[model samples]
Target: MGQKVNPIGFRLGVNRDWRSRWYASPQEMPGFLHSDIEIRDYVKKKLLFAAVSKIVIERAWNSIRVTIFTARPGIVIGRKGAEIEKMTEEISKMAQGKQIKIDIQEIKTPELDAQLVAENVALQIERRIAYRRAMKK
Candidate 1:
């Protein structure tokens, strides 16, 4: 038998870091945590077709910063960054008046990312491609 460890948990503070960077006061902790999950879910659902690889959320006094890592940055960015602007507005509403900053980061090698790779394979299969052929390539 082998021990199992979560990749994200194992890598935290090493190659990866905490999502919520700042500490919240006890009175504000619940609201902050709730807003974090709400923002994450809303963004993920809105960008479902954007080949999102990972989402990083950080908090500061009076503001939230969301950095989205995606295999297809252009989709999330849209023409003239319109998509991001709209997303920011939506997230601001979800945050209940906190300022929100959205940043998009591109993943150069989608194949190396497990989520991107799986999504790619699933998309190919949906388009009638053979799973074996897709995986073998």
Candidate 2:
């Protein structure tokens, strides 16, 4: 009875952008898509405590740029950025020798982000908090 659209998808290219900003050739599309998935999965698994909101990947001639948006930048950055360094090393291996650049962006308003809000709600529910009370704040 209602047409439901994802807020993020609806805003793409206007107020938001794609996670992977690359134009792949017809023959190369599958590989590129797979690589994107691998990179995203690696970040999610490695930085589970980071409260990551999004991972943006951009392709250059000889390098790939990965920008991670998270609610907890400190945790992702770690002490002196050692965690990021380690993640870079791991991602480099995944990249198959391509140069990789990693950037961490902090989310100032997690409450306004759909993904973050859902994650927060799920976390609260797991901790036995009431859904209404958790979402109220």
Candidate 3:
């Protein structure tokens, strides 16, 4: 059998860090892990059109900090910051009433990001554009 390893795992601590950051005891590990997965899924689905590339979730004492890295920051930060407030409220509910803080980081070179590039092509294809046409862009 061929050996396989996740690229991210291989580079962790070298040039990459885990998306979720927290420490938990054995008794609390399962719940915490599940919550992290749910939170990540919710954020991705909520910002489907915002070109979100990555989400970093950090827990400090009683608060949760969600850092969203996206190509389009304006969409994530809506008019007058109302979108952010709404998202915080929703995520707070998921966090069981814990404080939710959201921070947006713009990707300076989104065109050079592999994940974003792939997502762009997939979206174009989903819109009924030819695969060759999607790749050209």
Candidate 4:
């Protein structure tokens, strides 16, 4: 006889008695796992370039980093990192509780940052105009 068909298995993405088998079995060992948050934080820390930063965090552990990922981190970082320094002070107070860290990781491609910034600025301008029009009415 050919193999029997299982309707439930076909409908659901599982074999027959998959749940029961899973509950009945236990693995002897499992591989190490990592979460996205930890990885993101690690990347932020490693990728931050303070010299080119337009903003700098006095105490990285105490502030949230808002890195403007860009091909031209130099523009954002500004001369002597003054822009970043000012931004750090402005953001320092905003970091409440949890050790906050912000960083701007530069992308290899400049075009990407340009697109992102343009879209964001355009959105902001649109929102501002909408708000003003509403207020006028």
Which parts of model 3 are misplaced by more than 4 Å? none
Residue 39, candidate 4: C-alpha displacement in angstroms? 21
CA RMSD (A), model 1: 2.5
Question: Which sections of candidate 4 miss by over 4 Å?
Answer: 1-63, 96-101, 112-137
lDDT by residue (tens digit), candidate 1, 26-102: 99999888888888888889999998988888888789889999988999999999999999999988887788889
Query: What does candidate 2's lDDT look like per residue over 14-112, in tens digits?
Result: 988888999978998898899999999999999877789999999988799999999999999999989999998998988898999999899998888
Candidate with better TM-score, 1 vs 2: 2
Off by over 4 Å in 2: 1-11
* Consecutive 10-residue window with the lowest summed lDDT within model 2: 16-25
Ranking by lDDT: 3, 2, 1, 4
Better-scoring candidate (lDDT), 1 or 2:
2
RMSD values for the candidates in order, in angstroms, are 2.5, 2.4, 1.3, 15.7
Model 4 worst lDDT window (10 residues): 28-37
Deviation in angstroms for 31 in model 2? 0.7
Task: By TM-score, rank the candidates, best first.
Answer: 3, 2, 1, 4
Instruction: Score residue 87 of candidate 2 by CA lDDT.
Output: 90
TM-score for every candidate vs. truth? 0.82, 0.88, 0.93, 0.34
Worst 10 residues of 1 by lDDT: 16-25
